[model samples]
Target: MTDTTVLEQTQLPIGDWEFPRLEPRGYVEPRNRILKRTGYYGGPVKGAPSTSRQVEVLNQGILESPMQFEGLLSGVETLSKTPSVNDQFQAYALGLVDSPNVVEAGDVGVGKSTLMKCDYVLRALTLLRRRVVVVDKKQQSPTEPWGEYTNVAHTAGVDPIRLALGDRDGSRINMLDPALSQTRFIAGDTGALMVLQQAAALLNDGTPLDTWERKALRAALRDGAAQARARGRVVNIYDVLDHCGVISDELTRQMSPTALERMHEAGLTLRFILERLPEEMPGLFDGETSENVKLGEKLTVFDISQLPEDGPAVPLAMMLANAWTLGTIRRSEPGWKTTFCVDEGWFLVGGPMGKVIQSNAKLSRALGLSNVVNIHHISDIPADDPAVAFIKEAGTMHLFRQSKADDAVAAAQIAGLKPGAAEQLMTLPKGQHFKKVGLAAEVRIAHFRSELERQITDTSAGLTGAAL
Candidate 1:
């Protein structure tokens, strides 16, 4: 009933089934047609701002806009007579410009930390008027930043305040000031718990407390805090120790028989631990926080340089400093930027303080702050660590010459560089680094420091002076 034959037009092929791609068959006449490309070119285009105009906009953004920042210094292209477009220069310069966190890694003698201090941190302090808190852990060597950088800090009109633990003359930082604890608690921070944990860790050689011990310690701190409040005074660690020393019969009666038995043992163990802390760390945590320990200075350096790196003192000082900084910043006006410098980051990264540092990194942008973590190598950070998580959240990374191949490869991976770039990283000269900033391609920067910065940053200055 229906016509089964295909229509003549349908049978006629309009095009070949397998249309071959156009292949050049020798010389052919070139046809002239406008290509429709959809991308930006080097020069000005239809609806985009020019290079200089873009720079102007970026500068304007620095004032109050939500635009990203460019670098502190601009780069000059040397290969071509015509300068590269300023927009490209801005992008290249900002390649390693950090948002709120920067991770700088390299081997010894590679000038990684020096370059960061001289170039970025100093600029932030002097030009941007950002408050700086440095955890100075470098030992008393010719290259120690605490002593050597004093001149630079003075020149910047910042009288650097130093806190050296265990030094009788040094500023005292009480970790258990009830005022600080109560204020932070009222502000919704983990104040009482953090303080209790810090005290236990410092006492237990950085080990976590058992469940019963934690419960007992928490109860004692609460009671001590209440007693201190009644007397119109702030409680210290010693107050908690005193409360634990007298594990009250009234308090024990409220608990079940099993819980009471464990609680008593836990209280005794905690007392034993707390009593020995003052002996183990004499002149450091034995008394109230000194009046000299204030954050009103432009630069406050917790100079734990005298403390042994392998000991608990350094990390304890770091935790205290972290607490102080966070509380002070919380009270400060929002919009004022602060630079928190963690020199010799292994103290925080490889230790229990990494959790605090990780928390800081997460709130950095919201708090209008920047955290610089300078370490000798990526491997210094342990695997599956909160420190590693902090590094991953960093939008800026500066990698100096890596002496070890593994370090170079890890650095390359963090910077998102090509596989071949890892080899280049190992071969980079001193003061040169591969930097990545915010969604930008990696750039090689030859950092130049002034004579004063060189004098301030160079460790060999003292050696040369001694030689002379």
Candidate 2:
């Protein structure tokens, strides 16, 4: 009682105190000192809130704009909700791409072939109503003995033009066929002559023809064409082979003694090479293009899977088929678009053959054609090769997983991707790729497929035992 009375006398008055008194342990305030309020209440509010303060207000300009890839190719599983939709024609029309050319590079079993089959071939035909021609090199399987696209072509109600060495029933495409020469696509006789020279070079182990060799080859081709026209038939490789070593008096008159000797030697060497080509690659480029090798269908598959991988047959077949397809397209009426898909594109884009592919790519837009090249990796192609220029000129590129560090870096560099993209490319999962269209920034895309497409585009028949 004495302590409580002394404390109470020492406490200051509430109104006179500068600060609230500190309470002791177990202290309780009087009921009248405690503040109380009823349920819910608001202070007097003034004017309406400003638009900037409203939750619904948004800056439309700052919002991310959607990508305008018009054509529906696949679903995009990136940050954006837009589907991964684009084809060469639509991208070109939308001004999103400069050239109607596409390239796909990645490691094997990473879905390059599937994309080619689905997007470039099947979807191209069904969705866009465009024509597709596939230079199929991969064998269907160990038991099928046909191209991987054999079933795809059959699904489209057409048969693949199969080319096998020494098989009399196999299809043939004369590198010297006059149909290629007649169409001014790559330009008349000059185009045919180029094919011949390229074939000779391929036979010569990728060494281009020298001045003398070129002169000899040109003269022989001219003579062969004239002879074929006189005979009222198309010129074949055999016609050119017959005139290879024959030096006319005009050719002899134009050359000095030493030059004449060199030209003669060149002619003989070229003849020897051309002569041995049929023996080496029997049934190919030996006769006129087979009657069955027609582009009557919306899709045409030149099955060159039977050719030896390490030899010149693959490249020769690709070159001839490309030339033939271009000539046919040039002659066809306008408004219809075509896509030429070449798998194992390294074979077509190396050495002299690369120049032909490059020329075709340059003329892609004018001819209403799209060139789709599928290769293993950019690192596999030589840095100095002409294919490098063709690859760099592509308006669209699909980069899949590159297991090798160098390959990933090369893919990034070739596609002009930003920093850290190489690392992403190295780790990209199967069916996922980085798509770079024209000058736009590369976007990470996860390719989606339909159930029907999955069955038709499956290339793992050997592994999974799935029927196409």
Candidate 3:
């Protein structure tokens, strides 16, 4: 039947409303109509007309994801608007870094020391309740006659353990003190022998002892320690010096007549070096470790600022201080963490002392210690030096502004920064630094300090003539 006939017959009325009559048309298959309808809507839609355009196009590229850091330290604002907040220990605890050791490098007056004093030392003590041991090398001022951290140490309820050259009343640290050998890191005679070798190296203008000299020094240390124990006393450098020339039965079995003569001469030389130490730098390393050099408080500052910059006195004191601190920490019960900070760290990480620091850094985690080394420039240290290895071993780095382009490049390279980070290091303003935590992308951080912190952390008082 036709569509019109069908529609007319099916139409019905209800309450005077009848269905409209259907229009008659040629019949086509349903597939053809469906395909035609699909083609019309499948075409692309038109763009907005030119006259309807109202806003300018934003063609700038997209930004990267913001970085995030979390910890219990002071907050630092980042360029990406996220807070970069974590100390070395905190970062290590979070697995963001593999080692808790940190190296802070920058030029002078760029806030490296200030950040260390405030964020690492102060905050760690007050907030985390961690102990800190600082080998402070900078003087308070030319006229102040004390280390820069003297006031900070006092604030932490402890006096700075002052060491001075030719000052008879200054504190003393026995190079052969029994406590140095009492630590878990270096047991019995091993620790005392290491200290003696370091002392000999420092005294000889950074030249290490030859095999004969090492043998002589080791034999003397062993004999001296044994005699001191017998005498019911702890050994000192003087005791070791007295026993250096005493050839024992063990020496005869160890070497021929000619070798024995060379060994004896080497022992005399080491003895001479030790004998002259008291006259050269009096009251240091000549007696037992001072009663005042106790790590009884949360903060201990070894004020070695008065020692001459050109001599071995500074590094010698630092070495002893480090040994004493490690021995104390090792003997203490586990679960108590400590932060070991060395400002002007170049002194602590050069010559034979570098080996000591490297060893300590390797065992820092086992001892619950976070080692922090603050230096002015990595360029100052030769690339082949052992200290360079120690610097590289630090998993976290805070790089501040560097005055020289070479220095900036050296620091950036050591920190494994990207190509442009070296330029960033040169132009970074004061209080802003590039912080690289482990293998994560480095962040540009602006370190913020409150007024109280500013007052306490100020190292510019010497230059600015400001009150401490």
Q: What is the lDDT of residue 57 in candidate 3?
A: 48
Quality of model 1 by C-alpha lDDT:
0.65
Q: What is the TM-score of each predicted model, taking all chains together?
A: 0.74, 0.78, 0.79
lDDT for each candidate structure: 0.65, 0.79, 0.78
The local distance difference test score of model 3 is 0.78
Over 4 Å off in model 3, which ranges?
Answer: 1-69, 127-129, 248-263, 348-350
Candidate closest to the true structure, highest lDDT: 2
**Deviation from truth (RMSD, Å), model 3:** 18.9
| Cα lDDT tens digits for candidate 3, 27-116 | 633445565667853548876665423534444455563444566444444434445565677778878788899989998888888878
RMSD of 1: 18.3
How many clashes show up in model 3? 0
Candidate 2 global CA lDDT score: 0.79
Error of 1 at 298 (Å): 2.7
